[model samples]
Target chain A: MKTIGLYKYLPIEHKESLLDLETDRPIPTRKDLLVEVKAISINPVDVKVRSPKENVEPSPKILGWDASGTVVEVGEDCKLFKLGDEVFYSGSITRQGTYSEYHLVDERIVGHKPKRITHAEAAALPLTTITAWEALFERLRINSDDVEGNKEKTILIIGGAGGVGSIAIQLAKWAGLNVVATASREESVAWVRKLGADEVINHYQSFTEQLTNLQIQEVDYILCLNHTEQHWESMGDVIRPQGKICSIVETEEPLNLNVLKNKSVTFVWEFMFTRSMYQTEDMIEQHLLLNNVSGLIDKGVLRSTMNQKLSPINASNLKKAHALVETGRTIGKVVLESF
Target chain B: MKTIGLYKYLPIEHKESLLDLETDRPIPTRKDLLVEVKAISINPVDVKVRSPKENVEPSPKILGWDASGTVVEVGEDCKLFKLGDEVFYSGSITRQGTYSEYHLVDERIVGHKPKRITHAEAAALPLTTITAWEALFERLRINSDDVEGNKEKTILIIGGAGGVGSIAIQLAKWAGLNVVATASREESVAWVRKLGADEVINHYQSFTEQLTNLQIQEVDYILCLNHTEQHWESMGDVIRPQGKICSIVETEEPLNLNVLKNKSVTFVWEFMFTRSMYQTEDMIEQHLLLNNVSGLIDKGVLRSTMNQKLSPINASNLKKAHALVETGRTIGKVVLESF
Candidate 1:
């Protein structure tokens, strides 16, 4: 099986950062599905995990998470999926990732791929979609079923053109919220607007001022996909009293949590890997949500977020995708198809 | 009308820290209810707000909040209460407080007094009950209506013997959650146990070790009533993945919020004053929940947490109650009754 593996974490510019290797195809065990990788997407988590580090792996370390693949085999305990099922998943951080021709994932965290989209497009959806879904519905506790109740509610999606933000804008809109998205660049702004953002505000400007200009006093919720530290105070300023803020970005320093105290705001971290990493009792929620998202996609309520696609999944193509994502300005998602 | 007013922020020992002032009775308007104060309770907020500082008020500044009284007058717009109606409430922080012979409050935040308890007992409830109920069912999103669903959930309440924790323990228990409360003193431990805490742990010790010893690996929710900065990390350590943590205590410094990121944990502030302070659309929720609490108390499902009571609400009695609460060791609530 052809795989993209690394011996040591290095900058993307380095030739040795990612290498093509022939690794033995892994087998399925206890609720695991042996997925033959079809397409993969690059996310910030992939870059962060593969960032330059001093530690070296004794063996090849596979380094991808988002994948759209076919389940070639299933373990004895697997009930959600079967052999030949086309699946999509953001594989667990603790397990061997999906930067290989074949990967193993727990069936509880995998979803059947949206039949309406191509594999490359499907690959772009899993990681970001799962994150946006959980951050909106689970972490922030938005009642997605109550469209009438959500009509009066508004959500601000920070970094709206990024992978997660792109999907979050759509999901928030789908949930019947007044969606205000932040995008600084012209292309990014247009992209988010196209993705169903009712209002677009620049992330570089004062969120309060921008929202006020748009006749929004404060947002009912905020989904932060950019630097949590940089937007911490701005988010605090614009969130309504008793509102919720969910962030996927990891901050470099401690946060001044006191800023939100008077408003009694809720601050939640929405790491998509949390369920798989902890093996929580509700880990299967990811599977369920993903299936729901797939159904939404099939119904034409959501479009694939894949903005750029590279063919023949290889180290070079992944490195190229990594470098593009590293610029931190890529709109939507960058995917690689057909290893 | 006789009121306990302060001209300067001073230590509790100061002679003029609180003074009895003869003031004209206030009239009700715009959903306002003019209540003849019968009883009042001293909470940590009162002590904190009255803490020593250089600021001086040109006029006497009143400082108490929790009150049980009779509505002497009601504004034309006030439909929630009428003249002679007995009520209990924690008035908005933005308004002059409740340490007067006659106090004015918005009828939307006032609740019918529990028929089973005396004015002194009811006075001990409003501030703490509102804080606990909001922290549990609202901020933590625990469904008190879903007792069967809550049976599998567990909550660890820090500082179980304090004003808010006492009520939180009972409310969490009523919600059918397994409640673990923290107390260091033997008397405090016994008090929380009597309040229906399923288990009692010492906050001075490690929560992880204590819960593990009790065969509990982690809790689904944490209600923090003590110092948030001190328990932030420990609260993160024992919280189950995707768990919610609600804190009433303020932090002295920035918090390392990253500690909870891996678990996708929720950190929410449960400021009892948020709704009323912000004049939010849901400000009336306090009135609704307080009425629910009153019914619960009348039904014997909940009880007043008043422990010690002082007679003839005067400056001297208030000073003593403030001094006792400032000690940070007062179990239950210190209340003063009858002006």
Candidate 2:
């Protein structure tokens, strides 16, 4: 089977950073679904993982997490998915990822793809949707079922035009929260507004002054998809007492948890890979969230966040997608189709 | 009226650290409950507030929080309690505190005194119970109502023999969680064991080794009443994926929040004064918890944590109580009565 694999971690500018290879197809094992990959999406994690590192791999390493494909085979222990099931998943970080013609993934983390969207569009949804869903519903404990009660509440999304933020804005709005999103660029501001953000602020400006100008005192929740270290104090200043803050970005420095003490605020980190990495008992939650997102998409409540699409999933197309995402200001996701 | 007041923050050994003074009695207004103080408890907050500072107060500052007294008067807006009602509360830190013969507290922060206990016993409870209850059920989001479900979960309470930890052990046990508490002394270990801790370990020893020996891998919840900086790494090491940790003790250094990122653990600060200090919309939740605690005490489901009693509340006994608490080995709360 053909695969896009890396022999060494290198900058995208280098010729050998990503390469085309012919590796033996992965076989379905216990609870594994052998996905015949159709489409894949590039995220920040893919860039971070493929960035420069000193050590070189003895064997080729695959590094795509978000994919939409058809399950050609399933392990005997798999009860959730069957053969020829069209599915979407952000596969586990610890396992061999999805940058191959055939990939093995735990069926418990795969969800039936949305019938309303194409495979490329579906590929764009899994990673961002799962991240937004878990960060808001699981980590921040936002009661999506209690829309009426949440109507009076608000959430501030930092970096609202990015992959996770694009979905998070819509989810927060769907959950009946007034969405306050931050975007430094005019295009990004317009993009988040299109994604259901009620208000957009410039991230480069003081969040305090911006919120004051908007006649907003404080937010009940904050979902940060940007540099947490840069926004830590600002988020602390604007987060309401007893509020919650969830961040996906890891900080280079230690945070003064004291700033959150007086307000009794809760700070949680959301890494979508946690469940799969830890193989937690609740790993099936990802499958459930993806299914719900698929349903929501099919129902026309949510739209695919695919901003750009490339055809013929090869090393060059994958490289192009990676380059677009690496710009760090892409409005949404960049997906590649047809390996 | 008479009060124990301090004009300067001084060492406990100072001659004028805490002094008895005559002052005009305060009147009740706007949900204020003018309580005729009967008993008061000294907590670590008292010692910290009275700790030496460079700045001196222009007027004597009265410092006490936990108290059980009879409501001599209630403001017109106060419907929770009326005149002559026996009540207990951890009064707000912003207001003049509970060290006076006549003290004013918001009726919303006060609760009906336990029917089964004396004023001194009840006095020992309000602060610690509120802190423990909020930390567990609210911050940790432990469903105390779901005892059957909670039976499968466990909590590791650092400093579980201290005032807050004493009540936390009992509450966690009542909620059907397996409670593992930490204590170094023989007497404290015995005290926490009596309070229904499923197991006890020395805080000075390695928590990892001890838990491994006990056949416990990781805990679902961690209530930290000891040094958070000292235990931060160990707590991070043992917290189950998606677990919750609440700490009352402030850390001297910035915490590396990234350590808990992979596990997706939650870190919440539980300051009992948060609601009162912020005058949050949920300030009344404290009142509700206290009333529920009162009911629990009356029904024998919970007990007061008073360990020592000093009569004729004055500078000498108060100073001695402060000295004892400063030693940081006291097993339970200390109550002083009869001003």
Candidate 3:
């Protein structure tokens, strides 16, 4: 099998930052599906993993998470997926990734791909969709059933033009929340509004001031996809008393949690890999959420966030995708398809 | 009217720390009840309010929260209680407190005092019970409807012998969680066990090791009634992935929130005053919870934690109670009764 991987962490522009390597195809085990990777999407995690680090790998570290593929073989214990099934998944973070020609994923976290979407488009949806879904519905505890109850609620999504934020804006709108999204550039601002943001604010400015100018007092929820530390105090200032806030961005500094004490606000971190990392009993929830997202996408209630695509899954194209994501300004998702 | 209050923050031993003062009787307004206080309880909040500081108040600041009293007058808009009805409440933190002979409280946060309990016992309950109930059921999102489901879950109550922790142990037991409480002293351990903690561990030791010794791995919920910063790392370690943690104690320093990222754990602050402070639409939930707590006490499902009492609420007795709580080692609660 041919794969794209890193033997040592280096600048993406450096020669051999990513390499074309030959590896033996892995066999399916209990609850595993041997998937033939058809399309792969690049995320900021890929850039972070590929950045310069002190340790060199003994074996090449394949790094990719989002994929749309076909199941080539299924383990005997697998109950959900069958051979030749078209599937999409944001594979586990601790295991080998989807950059290989063939990959293995637990059947419980894989979902049937949206029938109406192309492989590239489907590949772009899984990771961001899972992140957005879990951050809003699970971590923030947004009530999806009560549309009337949600109509009065508001959510502020920082970095709203990014992959997860694009989907998050839509999901929050679907849950009937008034969506206030932050995007610095005009294009990004227009992008979030197109994705259903009720209002757009500048992330570089004071969030409270922007909200005040919009005649909004405070937000009921805040989903921070950008810098957590930089926005922490502003989030504390703007979140309603007893309101909830969730962030996916990791902070470099410790947070003064006492800022939220007087308001009795909640702060939750939503790392989408938590279930898979811990092998939690509810790991199957990922499969369920992906299926729900697929249904919504097929039903035209949601759309894929595939903003850019490259041909032929190879080291060069993967490196290009990584470089684009490293810029930290990619609007949605950048995908690669076909070997 | 006679009241005990402080014009300046001072050492607890100072004779004028809490002063006896005479003031005009306050009249009831819309939704207000002019209650003749029969008993008032000292909580940690009283100590915090009286702790030495440089600022001096223009007028003396009354500092008591838990009170049991008879409504002497009801405003036209007050529908929950009539004149002469005995009620107990942990009133709003923003309002003038319950240290005065006549106290004015909003009717909505008040509940009918348990008929079976004495006024001192009822006073001991309101502040601690409201804190415990909201921390467990609201902040932690414990499902009270499914006792069978709850029986499979576990909760760790830190500082199990404190006022809030005592009531929390009982409430968690009522909600069917396997309750593991942390208490250092033998008497405090016995107290929590008597309040229905299934097991007791010392908060000074490693919580994970203690839980492991007891054949438990991790808890589904954690109610932190003591220092959050001190136990934060251990709490993160012993919390199940996707578990909930609620705390009434505010952290004095910044917290390393990134530790809970991989587990996607929730951290919520439970200030019982949140609803009243914000004048939230759901403020009546306090009334409902207190009424439910009253029923539980009357039915003998929950016991009052009034461990000490002093007659005729006065400056001296109130100061004494405040001094005890300032030591940060008081067990259960201390109540000062009728003037």
* Cα lDDT listed for each candidate: 0.93, 0.93, 0.93
**What does DockQ give for each predicted structure?**
0.90, 0.86, 0.86
A283-332: candidate 2 lDDT, tens digit per residue: 99988999999999999999999999998988998888888888898999
State TM-scores per candidate. Answer: 0.99, 0.99, 0.99
Off by over 4 Å in 2: none
Pairs with backbone N, CA or C atoms under 3 Å apart (clashes), candidate 3: none
**Candidate 1 lDDT score at position A13:** 91
List runs of model 3 lying over 4 Å from the truth. Answer: none
Give the interface RMSD of each candidate: 0.6, 0.7, 0.7
Q: Give the lDDT of residue A332 in candidate 2.
A: 90
Clashing residue pairs, backbone N/CA/C < 3 A, model 1: none
Across B1-339, the per-residue lDDT of candidate 2 in tens digits comes to 888999999999998999989989998988998999999999999999999998789988999999999999888899888778999999999988888899999888899999899999999999999999999999999999999999999999999889999999999999999999999988999999999999999888999999999999999999999999999999999999999999999989998989899999899999999999989988999899999999999999999999999998888889999999999988889999988
- Tell me the lDDT of model 2 at B182: 97
Give the best candidate by lDDT.
Answer: 1
DockQ of 3: 0.86
TM-score of 2: 0.99
